[model samples]
Target chain A: MFFHIILERNMQLHPRHFGARLREKLVSKLIKDVEGTCSGRHGFVVAIMGIEHVGKGLIRDGTGFVTFPVKYKCVVFRPFKGEILEAVVTMVNKMGFFAEAGPVQIFVSNHLIPDDMEFQSADTPNYTTSDGSVKIQKDTEVRLKIIGTRVDATEIFCIGTIKDDFLGVISDPSAAV
Target chain B: MSGEEEENAAELKLGEDFVKAKCLMNGEVSLILDRRLEQLQQLSEDPLNQMPQVFEKSLQYVKRFSRYNNPDAVRQVREILSRHQLAEFELVVLGNLCPETVEEAIAMVPSLKDKGRGLDDEAIEKMLTDLALIKSSSSSGHLLKKLGFGLASL
Candidate 1:
């Protein structure tokens, strides 16, 4: 899920960038520094929506650079256990398949797939139902339930399952073609 | 991250931080990101190289999955769903998936089936109908554009 929330950060600015457009410099620098970064606590910071506050600059005794405490609102994506998500399949293998829901990567192991759908190893590897009516391959969109999540400083990985009722391939790019 | 359990817990255990934060639907994110892209293009000649990986992936994901593309339709969809008094997470999930039946909706969002919740099957069915109505109307609008009738009509 995507969230719009305010987060605080301490930004250091060089003496050379302390001219007429100080706020502009700070905003741009904040975007460059903060966007795409992930933290275990808050998940991935996708974009900086707006700056809520910039506290008084505190300068060190020796260095001429100024440190400013900036509070800004941003959009973040995070996945939680038991949360249902729709993700696009990126790869398929014998063990399982990897699908991505925005920045979060989820793995649905062979045990998580329904029993009827058997993995077929061919030129185009995929998991197909007995009747071949339902197929999961590259670019297939699936609705899955996250059973567990591992959050690291820079990334989050999830173990998802499509074995539950109403959780399976939602769209097949191949069928559309 | 600490907060009231009632306020923070969506049927699913979204952590305290996520529950407190305002949730955005795929359609809303797509709109916000599209505007940001336009601004970035105006700012520099080679902005794509400067784009963050997260932003790039999210933009593509939302654009591909967002059910309501137009701002008016997005607003209407929100208004219709908001009337049902759903959790922000549930509302967005329903909006994103656009399930066809009450059983499917309840299945997609199991919280709706939980006891003590006032949302009954009839209400769920009504909400699905309203959502489907908007979806069909918007899709047909796109169909017209694809058929070249939209440009001629304009």
Candidate 2:
């Protein structure tokens, strides 16, 4: 889930970043520092939207680093329980399958799959139904629901299920017609 | 929606509007309920709405959900499941799946297996059958399902 939020941060500018295009320099620094970074509070900062406001520069003693309080809008991605997500199947194994929806890595345990679908080990491990109507393998796009989620400081781990109806393979790359 | 849920929806709206304007976005699935597609459709219809090329192309992704696109039917199905006091997970699964039989509903909701002491199969069958009637009416109205081998044939 992505949320558009205005978050505050204190940006420290080095002496070299002092004049013309200094604001641009500060923005570039902010993006380099903030984007792709994960926090316990805000999942992942996908991108910086726009600068809300930048406060007056506060000079630090001796260090000569100018600190500015910047408020900016950003898109934060956070996964939540019970949300249905469409993800690309990254791997398939005896235990289950691993899928990725953006930065979130989802584990769809075999126990959470529809009873008809079974894991078939081969050159490329896959899970297929008894009737052979549905097949799940690497590069397959699936619709799944998050049963559980844990957001770490660095990454998001999700427990997902495809047992529910309308929550399975959306497209099969291997079986493309 | 409750006050907190409304606030959450408002925040979600802000996120969507940002996605419409700035062209940066993406999801968790559960955070997105079954009902917001209509609102998104309305947003897409707005001449002022500026969606990125990716989002416009990906509108097909939302189209895949045409089966569960009926808000009224979904609400009714959710109500029936809640009246039965089914667990939240079971309710959501049933609402989205719209299972027509006790067996179908049971297949979608594993929670039914553990909570089966008092909840009989017949009761679930009836509720689901009723849901099916409601769902069939709505699904017939959905052009996407009718476009090819209908899910109804399954």
| Residue range A1-177, candidate 2, lDDT tens digits | 445578889999998978889989988788778876777555667556679999999999999998999999876665556556567789999999998766667999999988878889989999988888888999877878777766666766889998876578864322212
DockQ of each: 0.45, 0.06
Global fold similarity of model 1 (TM-score):
0.89
Model 2: residues with Cα > 4 Å off, grouped in runs:
A172-177, B1-154
Judge candidate 2 at residue A176 and give its lDDT. 18
**lDDT, model 2, position B84:** 83
Interface RMSD of each: 3.3, 9.4
DockQ score for candidate 2: 0.06
CAPRI-style docking class of model 1 based on DockQ: acceptable
Among residues 3 or more apart in sequence or in different chains, the pairs in candidate 2 whose N, CA or C atoms overlap within 3 Å are: A1-B27, A1-B28, A82-B30, A83-B29, A83-B30, A84-B29, A84-B30
lDDT of 1 by residue, A60-122 (tens): 679988999999999998776777778999999889999999988999999999999899998
Error of 1 at B43 (Å): 2.0
Reference interface contacts recovered per candidate: 0.55, 0.03
Which residue pairs in candidate 1 collide? none
TM-score for each prediction? 0.89, 0.56
